[model samples]
Target: MPPKKLSISRIRAESRVRSDDPDLNRSSSSNRARKRYRSVAAGSSSSNASRYAKRKRPPQPKLSARVLSILEDDMRETQVQNRFAPDLRAERQNVSYRPLTLTQKARRDGADFQVPTLASMCCSIVANCFDSLLPSRDNFDAAAAAAGGRSASSSTAKKPIKNSHTLKKTTSTRKRSKTRAFGAAPDSDGDQQDYVPSEDDTPATKASSRSTRSRRGAPGTASSISSPNQLLAGWTTSELHYLTRKTSEQLRLLSLAASFLLYKTLVEQAPQYLTNTIISTYFLPPILSSSAASSTASTAAKTHVWLPASIPLLSHDNSAAAFLVGHLTSAITAAREYRFTLSRATEEDIPLTVLPSRLSLAQPVSFALRSLQLHGLTRLQDATLARLFEAAEPGPQQQSILRLDTISLRGCIAIADRTVTAICRSTGSTLRYLNLDHTDITANSVSTIMTSSPDLQTLKLGYNEHLSD
Candidate 1:
């Protein structure tokens, strides 16, 4: 029939076969190949990633029931033991605590073994006297009450109730009195002007008025009678008699302690007390005597009073040395007869120039030194030594009056021929002992010393490298 109506299925099957052929469907085949390649590449990448990835850790095994029960039992036993344990915090805290009975026993034992010295007894008596002399709380209260009562009575007596007319008259009279008191000139009308005080007038008038008010207000005030002497006025005559009855030695000790306390406590407040003749005569003697004693104990006792033992070795750099030298010079001047030894246990270098200058004394330092130990003056110079030797006031004969019985220059490395020569020339007549140890002095200086110092009993030239026979 009609050239053959092609069936739809037959047509579709032929088209599909054609499409499968590579020649007929080149673009589709290329796409299919690309997809296959991409799939392969993705698979390879996944495999590679899996191979290189970090491995997870294996799970830990669970505890067995028996082990768990054992741990629980152990924990329970620890908890029970902790609960039953004694609370020792308080007991431990009291480890160092001593009972009253034990403390008393220890104190009694110490007292029984301890033997008090005369010095200790004297000190205790003096301390007791000082304590007794001091104003007590009750005395202060009584003084305050007396002062208040006096002020109140004086105020009441001075200020009486007055009528308005009388008050006006009083005020006018007061203004006239103030004008007269301030030396203010009256006006041409003969009436005192308003009198406004200047700054200078105000201060003086205020001071005078305050003083007058104080005198009128409270004559028995503590401030009016609180001086040291006034404070001592309250002491019974028997106490004064007891003090006067003390032996001279006891008096001297008391004076020494009193002076020391005064100087130590009130040096800044009242330095004029240091210049008191009574203090100089009584207080300085003991100090000078104590300082003169060559014994170690005596030296140690007086060391802290003037020269503290804690002074640094480099004394030249320390202002404390200057302060000490100044005070020492004054002390020497105060007690001239007593021969003192100026010894530095630490072997510090003292500036010889400071001695002659007398920084603290109005006059030059004058003393006949028994011993002058300049043991560690490494930087001491010849000129300084000469100046020190010539420090004394010249006598009528124009000769040095300085008398040094002993001069120790040990470890003074700066000493040279000039220094030795100067020392021999200045102090040669009186110099009994001279130490030139560890110095730069030569044989020539030694010869000069021998020629000059005929009475030299001791000459120490050891460790002088420049010295030769």
Candidate 2:
């Protein structure tokens, strides 16, 4: 084959002949050359076949059941830890607890969003006003005396249970512990409303004796002796505000003074003791006195204003002493920086004023509102203020008692409708603790609150026998 080489001119002559001759056509040879060129360009040459062969995929690592179970447990624990960890800075300090919500933004900045929901504002205002009151030892002694002495002895012995004042010290300590876990410092504005009481862990006998002595006197008798440190006890919100138009001046002064002291104590023991006390007692003079028509042109000397001798101001906590301390410290500082002028007739004279917009809280030190006098609140006017039931989500860093307690608003003020609605909407099915002791709420309110909330566990309706659906 190597000896059969042909010249270029001979090959060209043969190709020309083949092009015209059908029997000698070169189509097959030309196709073979095209295929050969394609194969070389594609890199599919026979020499590279082994190197380009397909490979099997690597197997995936298999996890054992034990390893999987461990992973799941770790995930669960992490979730729990995240949920339980409280925000230290915001939880115990006066901070807004509500996250920025779509509806709130619309309502807050919207000019047309007015529906007369003043509960939160009122609470803040009242709290500030109360904080202004200075705690006086004289007030506590007088109130204790007026409540007919803490001893079980009663002239109307028919209701033996009513006169009993014995309380378990361990129970009080437990209450204090729980409150300490929940309470935080008030903001600089001094608008905080929640208070937790201190625990007096003395023997039950000792504690009862102290309480009895504090109360054993003519309603309105004043005592100079320092009460046992654990003498202060908590009341329901309604009890704190049980004002009557027929109250004596001495009793009114005592109620105011005791409230002031409670505020002082709370402030001093921030992390340990705080209290949310509601004072609802007062004696209101008649706006239109029938006796005025019979008065001879001579004006009678003003009768000593009557105050409640046995006023049982209700509160929603354990002790208010720690709360009082916070307000005292802040007020002292505020008085130094600003000049406050109050009229004799105004509640401000008793230190109850609107809270300031700005606050200067320092570290663990915080402030609270102090109101020593009940201006318009009275027993007969109780119907008016009673009709003024209001509810609000407590400020940030503060826990809402509504979150943990049930609330009944039967005969309370209709004006509280919006506040109650707001609380219901926020808490929904989680409302478990409630105290509607002797309120005048309708069955409708009770049903609505209960039906809407399925989580209620503790309800104090002892005085609210009227509540029915």
Candidate 3:
């Protein structure tokens, strides 16, 4: 059915007619209002029904005492673990080890535009940091005008002054105050007043008393810098430091001389080690001074004036002989170069008896003295011997001690049989005096030497306990 369309003019004419007829018009309007109400109610009801239908849920398990009890038990277990065994728990969801805080910004005035901004705060922080590194202005403009604008900011910041000038003043004043507060003033009689020390004694008094006690050779203070090297006995740091700066040759000669003095001191100290007739006769000085002071004064002699710095006496490890050989070789070279013969060189110029290479004296090849002048340094192992004969090659002078016709290791120890055998093998015929007195050499060594050197004129094996009777 194609509905008929009413013309606007016809509708308007009908509306006018209706207005003229009041009762008909009222009835028609009432009908229209009722129809509108019905349509609105129907639409609203349909929409609400669809909404409720979407919201409705399936039946759920009601809240029960058992579920509540279980929840409470689980919570208690977690609480117990957190209290006692915290390590057992899992980490938080969004966990971090660092303590993070929210970014904060402050509003200054009623208008946020006039508020202190982040840029201003940052600038202030930067300025503060810059000011910390530099000296603060003493007479800062205190009357910084508080202008109506936010830019007018006058901050007065200070910390306990730690500048050099302030520190010096404070320290000086503190010391003066301490002295005045602690020390007793002189009485009217001009007699020194002794302030009896009590529990309330000040730090200044304690420090003064400690210094006095140190001067008096306090128990723990004395022997604080003693070295294990018995050679550096009574040596001061100032003297050692001074000597270390000298030329190598000077150092070698001076150190050797100093060692010789110290060695003599060690002997005179009445060493518990067994002494021999050879040592007593040749090595020890006629008037052996036992005191350490006498040894120190050995440098006071006019001859040692070349050594401007005080000599430091120090001994080293098992290779003390090896160390001595280096210095001795250099010392000999220096003495030969320089016209002056050191006391050490003079003392060492006895004969080609011991390792005469230890001395600056040039040993004549024609001589043969079997007696050895071992300086009781049993620590002289094969290496020490190697260092002694390092300069002298294996051609002809290799057999004889220090390229001399004689060899003596009297009162020496730790000389192995093989060491002696090697030496015997090297020497063809120039060998004459092979003195192995009171040495650590065995019978096998003596046999090897006899076999090796058939024409050995003198083989003084006296006091050699290693040989069979």
Q: List TM-score per model, in order.
A: 0.29, 0.20, 0.29
Error of 1 at 449 (Å): 1.2
**What's the CA error at residue 177 for candidate 3, in Å?**
22
Tens digits of per-residue lDDT, candidate 2, 1-469, equal: 5788899999888766645677567468778999989988677665466455544334423333432343357454233222322123334368556555657867777976644345434433433433223222333454465464534456656654632366433433233122333355545223323433443435554545666656676354333343322223332223333422112232244333333433333322221222222221122111112233222112211112211101212111212322322332333343222222222224444433342212211111111111111211111122222211222233455433223233332222111223335545545456665544333344555656777678777655443333543
Worst 10 residues of 3 by lDDT: 305-314
**Candidate 3 lDDT tens digits, 1-469:** 9999999999888777745666656667768899999999999999999999999864432323432343357454233223322221135435654533222222322334445456444433433332222112211111121121224332323446567677644222222112334355635222323334443356667667666657567645434323322333334444344433342223133343453443333333222221232122222221112232233223211111011000111111344444444543332233222222333445777344532232223322211222224433333554445333342324353233222346655434445564576556545255676766545566788778878776678887665555777
In model 3, residue pairs whose N, Cα or C atoms come closer than 3 Å (at least 3 residues apart or on different chains), thus clashing, are 370-433, 370-435, 371-408, 372-408, 372-409
Task: Estimate the Cα RMSD of every predicted model relative to the unseen true structure.
Answer: 34.0, 35.7, 42.0
- What clash pairs does model 1 have? none
Query: Top lDDT: which candidate number?
Result: 1
| Residue 79 displacement (Å), model 2 | 54
What C-alpha lDDT do the candidate models reach, one value each?
0.48, 0.35, 0.40
